[model samples]
Target: MNAIGKTAIGLVFALLLSPARAADINAGKSRAAACMGCHGSAGVSNSGLFPSLAGQSRTYLEAQLKHFRSGERVNATMNAMAKDLKDEEIQNLAAYYAGLPGKSAGGDAKLAAAGKEKAAMCMGCHGNELRGNGQFPKLAGQHPDYIARQLTDFKSGARKAGPMNPLAQSLSEDDIKALAEYAGSLH
Candidate 1:
């Protein structure tokens, strides 16, 4: 290969090997100002109807935003919100949200314990701690109503094409309740 081509290839390798640049939290906070209404002051949604973003995995947030933007995940509000977001804004938003503290589900201890059995199914993807890895999302400390609604939506086909749909289809209402209660009780 030519010397110029080799140098260019070496530079590309160096770039690829370098750690990703740290996200700018200040920039993220600035961008997140627009998210405060439904997502609360720092991504902890005050309403049970909206899922909390605080302490969520950045990859999960990024994927969901992209999904909303691409029409794979369709929510009237989210679609609209995500449509105009640049990719960098999405990453910044994810970083900001992930840096904040998560809220509690506040379900009863017994119910949470019962739900732990149901949550076993979730362990495959959500991890043993239920905090989730990249792209799976944190179920720990999520709101009961939100979790139930999502499970119900998956069961009903309102939320389409996710692996959860099939799993949710197999869950009885009581199972859903127990799972939601359990997941919500986590820190």
Candidate 2:
């Protein structure tokens, strides 16, 4: 190629390979307006159908958003929402949600105890009270019904998770319920 042609191609490649801009938390809030309906006004859903997003780890949120966008996880609503999300938007959204405080779910004492036992093995990855770590999400304040749905979906291969997939397969329905209850009981 001629020098001018090479220069033009180099510029195109540079633009294509350029790193994404830093996430804008303010812009994320605006983008998240559409998510408030199901996820909650501040990331806590009033209904049990959706998982709360407030106080979840940014890393976890980012990973899940990428998964939804890539179809590694299946959820019609999330897939569509994430499909057009830019990389910076994902980072910003995660930051915005992670910065909020999370509320815990309510559960029966007996059931919570049982769930604690069930969740004991998960502490290493999920953190104390299953509040989550860098790449894991906080579950302490999530709704029991939502937790149950997620666990069931993971167990049934409907969600298609990496660690949760096989781990859930080893648990019975009752175990899943107990775990969800325990997680819900945590604040």
All models: lDDT? 0.86, 0.89
Show the colliding residue pairs in model 2.
104-141
Show model 1 residue runs off by greater than 4 Å: 1-8
List RMSD in Å for every model shown: 1.8, 4.4
Task: List residue ranges in candidate 2 displaced over 4 A.
Answer: 1-22
**Per-model TM-score versus the true fold:** 0.91, 0.85
Among the numbered candidates, top lDDT falls to 2
lDDT of 1 at 92: 85
lDDT of 1 at 2: 100
| Residue 71's lDDT in candidate 1 | 86
- Cα lDDT of model 2 by residue, 22-116, tens digit: 77889889999999999999998878899999999989999999999998878899999999888889999998998888987788789889989
